[model samples]
Target: MTSVYPYLPEMIASFGVERKDVAKWAGATSAVFSVAQSLTAVPWGRASDKFGRKPIIMTGLFCTMCFFLAWGVSTSLKMAIIIRALQGACNGNVGIIRTMVAEMVQERELQPKAFSIMPLVWSVGSVFGPAFGGLFAKPAERFPGLFGNSYFFNKYPFALPNIIGGVVFLISLSTAMLFLKETLHSKRHSRDWGLILGRRITEAFKDRPFRRQQKLRRYSIQDAEASAPLLQTDGTSRPAKAGREKPVAPSMSSVFTRQTVISLVSYTFLALHSVAFDQVLPVFLNYPPQEHTPRNTSLPFFFSGGFGLNSGHIGTIFTFYGITSGVIQFVLFPPLCARFGVLRCFRVCVLVFPVIYFLLPFTVLVENATTRYAALLVLMICKAFAVIIGFPCSTILLTNSAASLSILGTLNGFATTFSALGRASGPALAGLAFTWGVKNNMIGAPWWILGFIAAVGSLPVWMIVEGEGPTAGSSDSSDAESTDAEEEAVVFDDDDDLLDNLTTARRGSGREQQGLLKKGSEDTRNTGYGTVR
Candidate 1:
């Protein structure tokens, strides 16, 4: 979509369609794609748990490759839309990949670092996707028969770029299929569906050790109160109770509790703001000048030279942001979380995002070539920081929250779905805002809107609790220990039974050394020791 966006006008012209109509069409397509794409996360996650992560991932990749190939060869709008929809339907691996990594890696301490790498890779993809699109979309006469006649060039000048995208997808698909391994643990076959589901739910509730700790604290308080009379200044004495105290009511885990739900809602808003800003930035930046002049081309060195952004550049920027964020997640975030706590780190990131968006609108204000270039550079740096901080932090929070709930897979799917919805809706909303602003001759208004939206979105981050009970890592460790203990007990019982069997066999066989010697002596003498003589 990033690569082919430049040819939208051309496509509209060829199809004899209005810009508004095209925008509506694209927006609708985006929404549809978003909803379909969201569904893949949880099911893929559950499938990973059921079968294996590797196979499910490979399946998704295969589907993506096929979809992209179809998209590249699409001859009409209907074909393109269908292909795009299919692509959305198939590319549902992100959430699954997140879960797989979480499952495979221990030291919940490493989670932030591990998750950061995803955004980094996405950023790299963003940089290349459009550059390749722009490069390949060049006139066919330039390459002649490089890709056979000028049919593609005539019908769709950007066809080569789409082909490149398809090829990339294929390569990615193959690499994933060959290299990726299953991360989830294998479970025993169970014919009892009710038991399985119930157990999973029960485990989720039980996973939160925070509740247990709370119970212990309450019990300790009660014990302290009960013992207070012994230490009273009046020296009152009471007989000790022989009966045990009633058991305390079980404490509910906070993983899927109200607090977690609020945090998720906050994240949803942040996602909405982030996606909207990302979607609209390019449109706002590359707005055509009111009066066409050669001077307009003198925009800025960054905008004119290597860093210059067209729509493709915008996509590249997003890809860069994604890759950078992913990297931070995989490499930097875990350590940061361990040091600062997830909520603290998340709040800091959320607070900074709006500032970055605010600065983006000012890029156009610096008219001097160097100043304007510097402004754009600053914007990119800030944007990179925003991505790095916001993404990994949010993901860490979500994963941590889910881990607490023992519904990591389900929560992950839900998060992905909401994220997708935001991503899908954001672009269309941004497009609508941009189109309205531009048509109404309200220059730079959309940037302000984006910034304001981002600022408002940050409000939700405040709801997140710091140092909420046990970290996900600690919870997992406790669970592992419990499982080990259970296994050890079973082994101990088996050993005990085996020891009993051996003792019985020895007695039954009369295999004691002394017994054997006495029997042998009695047989030789035809009498027992004293009696034999």
Candidate 2:
């Protein structure tokens, strides 16, 4: 998707759209893709819960690869829209990825670093994607000596970027196919062809006898675990090893608690405006530069102009931002989150977005190229810094709000639907806002609108109650009048359909490791989320 950004206007115009309406066409394609994602994200999440994370992830990657190939060759706007939609339909993997991270890293303290991995991965793609799009689009014209007489290059002006994107997707898909494991507990222990094949391939690289021995040893371990006897809790003489937990149907009624709703609301609004910002920034940069004679306009409210940069320069700018973002994620965000705490860090991140949007139009006024670049660097660095803090912190809170570890995938999936809806609406609204500003000579109109949205998004942050969760087994609660009869009913593991009847304990509690280790254990008592192994 980032690969398409640099050449999106050119791509749309090649299909007969007028220069004035290219933003509209671009928005249409982007909107269609997001709408498709919105429709499928929840279903895909549910499928990950029911089937397994690895399968859905592989399927998404495969679909994305196909979409890239198809989109590369699209001859008309209609074809572009269709292919983009298909691309969106397969991209419900983000939530599943988050779910896996939450499951894999159980400690609350480690969550900021863990969740930051996805955004960092995206930053890597953003850096390369824009570079590819800018440098490679319309190769026939850019490098006529090499591609001038090639019919393929002439007919498919935008093919190079998509081809590169396809190759990247293929690499990711291959990696997932060979090594990715199923994170869903219930679906785990089932045969994983990827891991098995991965082992076989690795062993094949060794000497023959070494390979055979490794395979034999591997099989012995797996077979012993598979054949392990179930532990008896009845105090019988039979001493047995731990065995697979019986599968239980996950219940969803309790998933959407008050905290969950609050988190989703903030997440949705954040998605809405941030996506709009991304859509409009390049278009704003690509707009015509203002002349020496200034128009009769008020400061901030009435303005008409842009950075007037070409695709290559614009892509380089975005690539710079991507690198800066990765740096901030690695060096800044985690430390700040750790020192100040996730909620405080999140609130500070949320509060600054409106200011960022408000300042964007001012960058257009600078005449000196160096000054303008400096301004952009500052604005984008701030934006990246905030984003790096916001997304991971938000995800951690979202996971905290989940009623059961089992429902993390479902909760993330369910929430992704709304975020996808926000993304769906963002491009179209931004296009309209940009168009309106162009006609009205108030180039800052879209910025103001987005600023308002960011302000609105900040509202729910205050309402959110951030903690590890509703901590279970805390002795500090004031319930002086309560007796044994008034105590919360004990829930046995066998009795809980969600497989998690109680909440996770306070962060840093000793029970955190216990709850994580005992996951999916059949004989595990109905203990609070804090105690397990």
For lDDT, the strongest prediction is 2
Q: Write the per-residue lDDT of candidate 2 for residues 116-147, one digit (tens) a residue.
A: 89888888877888888888889999999999
Residue 423 in candidate 2, Cα distance off native in Å: 0.8
Please write out the lDDT profile of model 1 over residues 37-79, one tens digit for every residue: 7767667655655565667777887777667656555667776
Tell me the spans in candidate 2 whose CA falls farther than 4 Å from its real position. 1-4, 206-218, 222-252, 469-533
TM-score, per-candidate, Cα-based: 0.67, 0.83
> Model 2 RMSD to the real structure?
9.3
After aligning candidate 2 to the native by TM-score, how far in Å is the CA of 24 from where it should be? 2.0
Error of 1 at 351 (Å): 2.2
lDDT of 1 at 285: 43
Q: Mind sharing the TM-score for model 2? A: 0.83
Error of 1 at 424 (Å): 1.7
Show pairs that collide, candidate 2.
514-532
